[model samples]
Target: MNLLIQLTDLSIKTKQLELLQPLSFKLYQDKPVTILGQTGSGKSLLAQAIVGLLPSELSQQGQVEVFGQTHDRKSLISLWGREVIMLPQEPWRALDPLMPAYQQVSEVYQCLHDLDEESAFYRALKDLERVGLKSSALKRPGQLSGGMAQRLAVTSATAGGAKLVLADEPTKGLDVSRRDDIIQVLMNSAQGGGLLTITHDIEVARQIGGDIIVMKEGVVVEQGSAQQILNHPQHAYTQLLIAADPRHWKARDYPMIEKKPVLEAKRLAIGRNGLALSNGINFTIHSGEVVGVVGDSGCGKSTLGDTLLGLLKPIEGSVKRLSEEAKPYQWLKLFQDPPAALTCSVTLGVLLEDLVKLHQIERQRVAILMSKLNLAPELLERRSTEVSGGELQRFAILRAMLLEPVFLFADEPTSRLDPIIAKEVIELLVDLAKEQGCALLFVSHDPYLIEKRCDTVLRL
Candidate 1:
């Protein structure tokens, strides 16, 4: 077997965390490999380390051989895109916010082919169309939905002409229908080269039908064929993953409040470019209520969240926050992907402290809120990059809660979390609304979470 990628006894150490302790794995040409792990299992760290993007302070030991060449610290950086391309979980974060999506994709092609603008644009458009995106979506990353942005990332990575592709939870935010399409595309790439997928979704792994490498904490606990691993998982951790599927969650009655307008939107027209998503829309969120807004991937859920937060000004209509509380009010808007909303350089603690100071919140109150949210105090010292998606979402919620906002707008708050963690987050939101008399407008496509936690359901 021709090995395309191999890692032997690899270990990485950060100041506060040890990632990939004595990990060993291999990816063969024309074969797909899936790395299964929990939320903080260092799946992303392994991918980053392989692509030579780990920070300098994090010491890496052992061997990382690619294409029969031994790669150390210095050689790995220069060797990244020439041989291996990584599609990050938060695709839009990898994009240049200022550049249009078409231009961004064109840049990847230009790096590989030295093509002129017109040729690059034509190639980029073809790739975009291949991914089932419309030509009009040539707008910036901010304009695309979470799923669309992920497609863009895949298109861009493939365009880079790399022999191996490393995708981190590629289907995390995609809807059921879109997930199949993206998975097919990824499988096609594996047929052409080497594909390494890091995901918690066993169904996705089974669909691709490849080798499996199960990781726990920082070690690979199991390795076998896809059929063997899924059909008969030897490790208890892998079995636990199979059991924790969201479908197995017990359904409970979601409490609803009396219709008293806590927050009202009158003829709200949302969208960045005068392209109204829901024209002349009107809604009211009452105190002690949790309202869910459900729709297709790009159907303006995030835009609605932005408008509610006063971050995006509506073309026409009024948003009124009706709170009688004398205490300073805070509005926390949790993004679909925490990386998009959070700064990479700042630690979680510094971020919380900044929010506290910005909102003039007391330190003691912030401390109490952090503890209540189940976030470890140590997380405050680590940068946003160090935290997992679930932790970052919780941290974002805690920051918002620190200000004691009367209204909380959560956009896909549970998208990145596992079923249990997602349930816990929903419970926390319910408890917060009930205990603090705060109103919540939660947005998600997961009908189960909506049915379980929402006090009122609104379909967009």
Candidate 2:
């Protein structure tokens, strides 16, 4: 039970915001430590600081000791890839999109061992299979689903031979059934070595069944075994989080309203490279209805949404616009991981403005959309890298709204949003879709969200 990671008086600060303030904790070898916090509370920042991936603009103070050795900026830089590895929140960006999935994991193995590419490739494939991914997924990140991408990231980090693995919101966007599978993979990694999982989901922490540290505003509010803290949460924040669990949605009854069909998929078959991911799928979304599609990881829920949006061409059947006279409503697709979709080294405002200009929409209308989406007008000038995941997701949706498509396809739109904000976004989308007669197709694995907002459910 020797300490593998120790943080004493750790503080991280940006120009306007303090991420973590006077944080301290110790993580032992072969044990899992879950760091809990609300969004923008520095959970991910702490992970980044530990793995030397924190942005340069964020100044740090205090000691980060790994393997009983103190790590400063220099030591941390030297320790990365050997002693520590990070499974970032956005797995799509975490891996090089250009590299094949097998190569992505193999590269890590190659960096850590003396094995040739052939051996490393096989080892990577084994790791993927262990995480429930098929051997064929080793070809590309774009070809994988949200859950598969996450599994690939976890396998890559685990195969890297790092003594301490840092996973940020590892199961954030997974469906309930898949969440357990991903958690098991992370816990297995800890059993194999050590792990520090930073997450907002209490269920995830409980599943890990390890030491737990609750954080708020960059501070450790509670620390103890998962059994003690989760069962008898001492802090108000912890209790609030537990109460806010999305799983509670099953108990609440939502208003039911009759509406006309706005979008229809008639035996649709979606594929890429002559491979069908979604075959013979049929579903319909009404003007006010939010139809949710749920399935296991890589089960083609996202592929179905992509096909509905005309982003992916169907191979056999067609997705028809049933509402012929429906108003030209805007369709906004919030990605499962926003950073991957919003990155360009450009300011958030510039991207929005460009979209507005491309659509020949008035700038004033763009400002209004941003306000409706709860984004700061000033964020226009801020670089995409400067914003949080929730903000970026909302911003992307706002940008999409400017186009005014009649059908809206939201793919895990609230994946990065806090529970409260996630609820707000869901409500807003439903209201907007109903008010404007827009057909909405929302794809998520979270059954709770579907139960709350959807008029119909489709199991992929």
| Top candidate by lDDT | 1
Model 1, TM vs. native: 0.79
- In angstroms, the error of model 2 at 223 is 2.6
Per-candidate local distance difference test? 0.78, 0.77
Candidate with the greatest TM-score versus the true structure: 2
- Angstrom error at residue 123, model 1: 1.9
TM-score of 2: 0.84
- Give the TM-score of each candidate: 0.79, 0.84
lDDT of 2 by residue, 113-217 (tens): 878988987888787777777555547887777777877887787776777788888887777877887787777666756889888887888888788988877
Give lDDT for model 1.
0.78
Error of 1 at 253 (Å): 2.8
